[model samples]
Target: MRNDRQPDRPPLTTGAGWHRRRRGLAPWLLIGLYVVIGLAPLAITWLRGHPRQGLAHDLSSGLVMVGFAMMLMQFLLSGRFRDITGRVGADITILFHQLIAWTILAFVLLHPFLYAVPGLWPDPAQAVATLRGMFGSDALRSGGIAWWLLILLVPMAMWRDRLPIRYEIWRLSHGLGAAVIALAGLHHTLTVGTYSADPWLAGFWVVLAGLAVASLVHVYVLKPLRQFRHPYRLVSNREVADRIWEIQVEAERRPAINFAAGQFIWLNLGHSPFRLVEHPFSLSSTPADRPRLAVTVRESGDFTNRIGEIPVGTRAYVDGPYGTFTLARRRASGLAFFAGGVGLGPIIGLLRELVQEQYRGPVHLLYGNRVETQILYRDELEAMGKTLDFRLQLILSEPPEGWRGPAGELTPEVIDACLDGRFPKDWLYFVCGPVPMMESVEATLLARGVPARRIVSERFKYS
Candidate 1:
């Protein structure tokens, strides 16, 4: 093994003035706020001291109220707000959003069942009768609308890929469905809620619902307006690897979008920013390459398959610099990067940023691909070792003839062999790839005693 170690590595660049600073609530504080908001209605209702319904009836109301609170919060969580995602990272935020969604689903779905529990014992037929009565009640019409929409919508999101609809259509439907659920649920609550008749409790529901709708307005309306002012023009588009493209857009305004490397952007090319034609792509160019932003997109989806044919100088609008897959707010004595296929997009950006900043830490990359031709930035990666303390390991599962190198999936054996048991406690690990690969790599590192906090990753798809 050829070993090249820089004896005196310089200080970390993350906390320095070089990268854009990200500030948000600590994870504990954020969780605390979430719990408070979700339980606020329950607390307020308890204090109102209404004549208590029996345990089952009260429990049903409580569950629906908390679930409704959480459902409303979902809008803000998905709005891509930096203030919330800054400290904890986008991965944890998104995972939390997803997990809580399932919880909300459970709570809402159980609402009617719990309410019908009272009629279940003596005659099972009575439980069905109770349910039918609840569903058929004219006063509960808004509640019924919300209930049915939840049944149809949540599954649609979970099984989106299985559906025949396009992603844009699904996204629009999801947003509109969420809005309806919020409004209908609110009307149901204020109209028939036990404690919502109180002015203070009704006022709280109104305020929170307003904030929820405002979050949607912020993402769909306000953000698009801002993009119009800070417009960009697509300057170049070219293929970098098999079914992969690198696209660049130059800013038409004064200051470019300030972003940390390893972040991603939602790009809208030759379409109005207000339209639902944009797609998210990882930033392949370093932040130092600003005023001309670039994203590396894979031809995997409907919109991306045609990216290669986009003419140069097309009007482009970007709504990002989103995601926390960067080293901007972290400190690591050494860096280990794992990328599979097109996952290299952000990793390449991080490496380029390190080179531009002259980072002294030892950086090792283990890039995996199915075949040699699928490897991207081959020359650039091979040349990195000459400039920085870098090591490049290209692992191909299906090597061509006369090839003698690491050959396999990025398994535990592959990872251990690549790192050679170095800095398991100190080094920061970045893993980006397919879901299964990332999950397996993350579990492998954890089993090797790498602290969970030291690993960073971002996920766009969730089940």
Candidate 2:
């Protein structure tokens, strides 16, 4: 991996206000642009006396799938949409990505059936025989087999948890599967000659291919090469709790990157972000502390469990500043954070910001863990609780004997108890936790007169 990291740039700390401001104008702008471009294409067809396939169901399905694929590619490359829209949150993003992939799979299966099953179609056995006969010479025939292999491999990678597979191996398989899909689709388009037979279809293919190539360069080559130039070295690492560690990293050169609190960056230890094993982690430190970044992790998976094994002075590549949940533009009189287990990573970042800004209003923290041992940053939270205008409530699901703090999950009752009238109804709430805990907390908040607009939550997905 070459040193390809870019020099220090302005931090992308603007919050939802930026997105909201754009949102209002975006729809009208998009509508106007759509009318212009869309109508122009239709008008061209009319002027040329060509038949237009207006909005056929099959064509709509195909377009939707392609549009989603384009969005995925855009996200995997730009990292801009993810920052502006929670669409790219760790949990939400993965779910939608899987949904889109499965939807495409459905289109893949249905397109042929709808077109061929009724009439003007070869029988199954005859079609198979014909396919086999033409395999070597026909690109579409070869690609048909390739498509099946892609369909097989992608699903397997997605459900790899059910199999005896590691994340690294699954990631590699997923990438290869995508490559097979792209090549096969390209071949099929060139050979089948349905839409591809048209000059306009050729133009569309060229654009998609160009975008795909650009994304590939951004992910695999350009980004990794830049990381080589701005290598961040681990300066210190310490165990924060049982099976948890806090790592401090600093740049070795003048152009050290500064990361915004609550924003996440993809970390590459021995390999670059392009590597199959790279993972995203939120920066647990504030931007005021320049030239260094801190990330806290629990031993939840292979990569995290091995964090303790990473030697001091090891080089790392950071590929982000992505995420919408930040303290930059939030307009709340008071702030509340609910964290479950290791989900305290972003909460800690928020706390640091509050402390730095000398926020005098109420700030409440409700953190839950299985045991006292699993509670990360316990001492720091306690100290901050005493020093700032903040309240801290620690809950242990399974407390040891003689333990007197709150016990059990962060249920509605637990959240209510933690609040204890310290904050008002209009207080801003941020929750980060495992899926179940977050869902429960968010529901509880909404039930307790906290408006949906006031509650913010983040869900972390381990992939």
Candidate 3:
């Protein structure tokens, strides 16, 4: 590989440090709020004057109450709330959402089973009769509906890819199903719950259900309305590599959405934002270039494979500036980037920002791809090398005849060789890639003494 060097200029100053401090507090505050609200029903139940129940009965009631609270909280953690996801990153928030869903499912599943425990009631046959009455009762119809819906929803979500349904259809069904579950769960809680008979508990359920509905409206209605007012037009779309294309859009009669480097947007091209057709793509352009945003997408999915068909002047909607995978939040003596294939999208934006800001540090990149043709923005990356103390190491799993760059997977030996075994502990590291590759690289970095805080990564897909 050829080495290109350029004179470095002074780095630009900004209020990023102050912003980082403020944003850092948001996740903890949100978590605190979640814990308080989720446990509020239990706390209120304990305070209220209620008849004493056996341990199994009390435990069963407590499980369902907490489970319902968690179910309601799922609305806020849907990867749409910037206040909740701004600092933690959307991937982590969504991962938590999925994990928490399973937990709540388990709780709900156990609620009825525990009530049927023979030890809970003096007569085992009486407990069985009570269970049958609850299951067959007309008043508990909503509870039965919620119970079955939850049973179906979690497994369907887990095996969504294997289902014979389009992504958009699945999304629509998921949203509608969730709404039904929330409403049914709320009905059951207020009407059938022992503690919920209290005025305060009933009011709490009403408020949570209202918030849940509001969250859906915010995502499906209000957000699209706002996007309609500030739309973007496609400036250009061209193939950058074998299967990757660069999409550039210019805001219509407004400035582009302000976002830090390495952030992403939910891009909807030639479709209204109200539709569930948008896909998340990392911005491949720096904040320095406003009113014009770009994203590099690989032709992997159904929507992405049809990128070539998008007209040049199509109107676009962006719900964006999301994700915490940026340098603005962390300070470092140097920077290192490890990107694989299309994972270079966000890293490229960060590199451009470093160049634009004239960052004076030893910047290194270890970019891995399967073949040479898939390597994107080669010429521009080389130009960036000329503007900063940057080193680019291209790694290919398969190389052409007589190729001289590093070859094979991004193993520990390969990474050590690329950095010359000088892995800085304080330098910030950015990684974006396939899950296996990312897991391998992260383990290697941790083993090599890199602090976990110094390494930031964003997963491309959750499922």
Highest lDDT among the candidates is held by which one? 3
Q: Backbone collision count in every prediction?
A: 0, 10, 0
Worst 10 residues of 2 by lDDT: 1-10
- Taking the tens digit of each residue's C-alpha lDDT, what string does model 2 give over 308-425? 9899988777766666566544455567899998789988987886676666666788999998988887778888865567889889999999988898999887877788844455
lDDT pick, better of 2 and 3: 3
TM-score of each: 0.93, 0.81, 0.94
Order the candidates by lDDT, highest first: 3, 1, 2
lDDT of each candidate versus the true structure: 0.85, 0.65, 0.87
Task: List runs of model 3 lying over 4 Å from the truth.
Answer: 1-25, 118-126
Clashing pairs in 3: none
**Error in Å for residue 377 of model 3:** 0.5
Residue-level lDDT of model 3, residues 89-161, one tens digit each, is: 7998899999999999999988887888854457778778878987899999999899999999999988899
Please give, for residues 1-463, the per-residue lDDT of candidate 1 as tens digits.
0122322456754433235676667778888989999999888887887778999999999999999999999987873787887777665776777777888998999998999999999998999999999999999999999988988888888788899998889999999999999999999999987676789789989999999999999988999999988889999999999999999999997677888888888899999888878887889898679898888888887788999999998999988777778787566678899999999999999888888777877899999999998999999998888778898999999988876779989999998898896644667799898888899989999999888878888665545
Off by over 4 Å in 1: 1-8, 12-19, 120-127
